[model samples]
Target: MATKPDIVTLEALDAFDALIDARSPSEYAEDHLPGAVSCPVLDDDQRRLVGTLYKQRGPFEARRIGGVWVARNIARHVEAWMQDKPAHWRPLVYCWRGGQRSGSFVLWLRQIGWAAAQLQGGYKAYRRWVVQQLAELPPRLAWRVLAGPTGSGKTRLLHALAAAGAQVLDLEGLARHRGSILGAWPDGQPQPSQKAFDTALVAALRRLDPARPVWVEAESRKIGLVQLPEALHQALQQAPRVQLQVPFEARLALVLQDYAWLGRDPQALARRLQALRGLQPGEVLQRWQVWARQGRLPELFADLMTRHYDPLYQRHLRADDARATMLVLPGLDEATLAQAAAQLLAGGLARVGS
Candidate 1:
C-alpha cells in the first residue's frame, strides 16, 4: 500500500521540480500558480455534473459516482501525461484546497516510486499568500516612477531599461494590456483574471532585489481590467517621478507605430474611439472617424493627440508640477531610448536610493 502522501507548504514551493494544478480546466484557467501545468483530476463538465449530483442526490451519492470518474481521469493522466516522467521525477500537486483530487493523484504517483507531494492548502493557500505579498512587498522596495503623456513611449523605454540591466516592474506587461481606452491587444487577446494578474505581480516582485531601486511606469490604480493593490498604488504615488518630454511629432510617430493595428479595421477603431465622445466635440469625433475610414492615420493620430490626449495629459502635468524631474528626448527611437536608459543608469536616477 502507498504511504500517506507528503504534504508541502507554500514556503517550500521551490523544492519541487514541477507544479501540477489538479483543479478543473476552467478553475486552472482563472488562475493557477505561476509556471504550473494543469493536470485536472476532474474536467469542467465532470466537475459541474458532480456538483449537481451532490446538490440534487446527496454527498454520499455524488462521491460514489465522482470517485470512479476521478480515478479513470487520473489513470489517463498517468498514461498520457506521465508516460515520459522518470521514476525519480518529483512534482508538487494541488487542487482547490488540498482535498481528495490532489491527494489521490499524489498517492498514485508516490506508489509509482516518484517523489510526489501535495501542497498543504493547495492553490487557495498560494492565492492567500499572493494577496498578502501584494500588500507587503511594494512598500519595501524603492520605486522610480516613469511618468509621461500617452504615446510618449513609456513602455518602450521600460523595455529599454530592462535591456540595459535596470530593475523594472512592467505593470502593463503583467496585465497583458497597453493601459488605455484602446488597450486590448490586436486580434482580441483577453487579459488574465484579476487573480492571475496578482499572482504575476507578486511573483515579479519576489524576483527583484530590494537593494536596487525598481523602475516602473506611472499609472492609475486600474490597468485594463486589473486593479493595482492598495499598497502598490500608494507606493507608486509616493515614489520618485521621472518625466519624459518628447516632441509632439515624435510622440505621434511612436503612437502610430504602436497602434498600427488600429488602421486595419476603421469601423472597429472608430467604435473604440467613441469612448472619448464626451471628451471630444461631436463634429471632431465624426471627422476623426471619417479619417479613420480613409486610412489617414497621421491626421487621425495628430488630431486625437492634440484634441483629446494632450488636453487631458496637460491637466495631469499641472497637478504633477514640482514633483517630476524632466528627461527630455528628441525622439523615441531605439538608439535614443537606449542612450537615455544608459544615462539614467550611469547617472542621477540610478543614484536615487544608492
Candidate 2:
C-alpha cells in the first residue's frame, strides 16, 4: 500500500520540512544545499573507488560495485535516520542530480513508511538556481548604505537597526573582516571565496522584503580577499548613505573597547599597527612601532585614527559626493549608539547636502 511521494524542485524543497543532502561528506563540505545537513550514503574512500570505476570501467560495472556499497550504506543510514526522525517529520532528500543515489534513498525512506521526496535535478540544479538568483539581484531589491569612518561602529549600528525591524545585510559580517588592516578578528579566519560571498549575498537578498530597505555597510568593492559581485558593488555605489558621526574622543574609546583584547599581545598589535606603513611616512611608522612596543595602545590607536583613518575617509567622502544624513552619537556606549540609530531610523537628523 506504499506509494512514492512526488519529487520536489529546489524552490519547493526550500519550504519543505527538512533538507537532506545525501552526497559524500567531501562533496557536502565543498558546497551544498544552502541549509542542508549531509547524510552521506557513501564514505570518502568508497566514493573515490566508485568514481574511479565509473571512469575506467563505465557505468555498468561502476553501478554494480556502487550498488553493494550503497546497500550497506543505506542500512546504516536507516538506523541514523530513524534516530533523527520525529513521527511527523517529512524530509526532502537529494543527491548529485536526483539520480540513483537520491532515488535509492527515496525508495528506502518510503519502504520505512516515512514521507520523503527527492529533489528534482538535485544539488547541481540547486547551484544553478543560486547562480541565477545572484545574477539578477540588483534590480529586484531596495538597498541602503551605512557609511562611516573607521571605529564609528557602523557594523554595530546595522545590527541595532535590524533589531528595530529594519532589514539588514551585513557584508563585513559575511566576509568576516571589518574591512581594514586592524579589522582582522583575533581568531583570524579567512573570508570565503568571491563566489561564496556572492552566493551568501544572494541568499540574504532573497530572504529580504524588496519593499523594505536592506541596510548594508559602505565598503570598498573588495572586502579583504573577496570581491563583491559587480551588481552588488554597483548597487552599493548607488544606494543612499547614512553616515554616522561620533566625537573623536568617543571614536577613540570605541576603538579601544573593540580592540582591548588585542592589547595583551603587544607584538601582534605592533604588526597590525605596522600594516599602516604605506599610509604614513617612515618617521610616523617608526614612532607608531615604538608606541606599540611600549604598550601605548591608547596613543597608538588615537594617532592611527586621526592620521590614517580619518584622512582616508575624508578622501572617499569628497570623491563620492554622497548624500549623507549624519547620526551623531555623543558616546559609543551601547545605550547612546542604540538611541542615535533609532533616531536615524525615525528620520531625526540634519542631512548633509551634496
Clashes of each: 0, 0
Per-residue error (Å), model 1, residue 33? 0.7
**Over 4 Å off, model 2:** 1-6, 56-61, 83-89, 189-199, 269-294, 318-322, 351-354
- For model 2 the TM-score comes to 0.82
Candidates' lDDT values, in order? 0.88, 0.79
Return the clash pairs for model 1, or none: none
Error of 2 at 229 (Å): 2.8
lDDT of 1 by residue, 60-121 (tens): 98899999998999899888878898877899999999999899999988889899999988
> TM-scores across all candidates?
0.93, 0.82
Residue 209 lDDT (model 2):
86
Best lDDT goes to which candidate? Answer: 1
- In order, what is each prediction's RMSD in angstroms? 3.5, 4.1
